[model samples]
Target: MAKETKAQRETVERVMREWKDGALETSRGAPVTSQQQAVAIALHEAGQSRDETPAKNRKNLRTTKAREAKASETREVLYAEATKRGIPGRSRMTKQELVRALQPR
Candidate 1:
């Protein structure tokens, strides 16, 4: 882990305090309801958390986005996409399987 600057540390503290006070919000105008989400938002606002470098933070952000995107899709939607794509064995495939089949390469 890299050393965090005073400003960065302060940023985290401020954001966390906001979260604790029920004043923290996500970029999309949603109220931050989870400690994990608050921490991620705090670290992002600070440009880095104590535990990760900037590069790692960006990577984690990308991974979180991808997972959220996947989770946003319903099983019925996945099935429709799989059917449209003519995926093999889609009839018996699970929702996860359909998602994997439909995932962009």
Candidate 2:
């Protein structure tokens, strides 16, 4: 494995600081609740996480499909939640739109 560069470390540190300050969140806009969780998420975003298995030794296609299936399930759940809340025009909103609309003001 290649060594991590100074820039990568700096980036991770910055993200960690932001997360600790409640200024950063996951792609879904959920706040990170812990420093350890922040480190993992930051490293994954930087492509420097220690937990990634070698792609050649893994079933890449199956993993990708599984992730997609999970995302679809999440979208369905969000849609249903929005429907339950009686959000106007929910049927016409995309998943992300629903998410944004559902966020507390």
Candidate 3:
């Protein structure tokens, strides 16, 4: 395989940073999947224009949205149940907190 140029290396590093830091989320705040990351990397490597990145990113965003939506639905159900059971502070908890509280005791 050919060696990566500095520009290519920089681009890859940027993408990896975004992926690791959860910047590839949808407007609704869903985390992008590995598959989506792969697609974004592939597109970037192909020398796709910067202006076109958003469209390509949106495609991946859709998948993340779907996954997040499903997870949200499940969390809502769990949260409601927790509230009904008088779990203190459930109302104030964020999603991550809710998950921890709802985990099997």
**Which candidate comes out best when scored by lDDT?**
1
Error of 2 at 90 (Å): 21
Q: Give the alpha carbon lDDT tens digit for every residue of 1-105 in model 3.
A: 335555545555656666777675543567776856555654454344354665664554344344334446666786896788778988788776676566444
lDDT of 1 by residue, 1-105 (tens): 667777567767878998999998785668999999999888876668557776886665455456447757998988887888888899898876776677666
Worst 10 residues of 1 by lDDT: 59-68
For TM-score, candidate 1 versus 3, the one ahead is: 1
lDDT per model, in order?
A: 0.76, 0.67, 0.58
- lDDT value, candidate 2, whole model: 0.67
The estimated TM-scores of all candidates read: 0.47, 0.45, 0.32
Stretches of model 1 off by over 4 angstroms after superposition: 49-105
| lDDT of residue 81 for candidate 3 | 69
The predictions' CA RMSDs to the true structure, in order, are 10.0, 9.7, 12.6
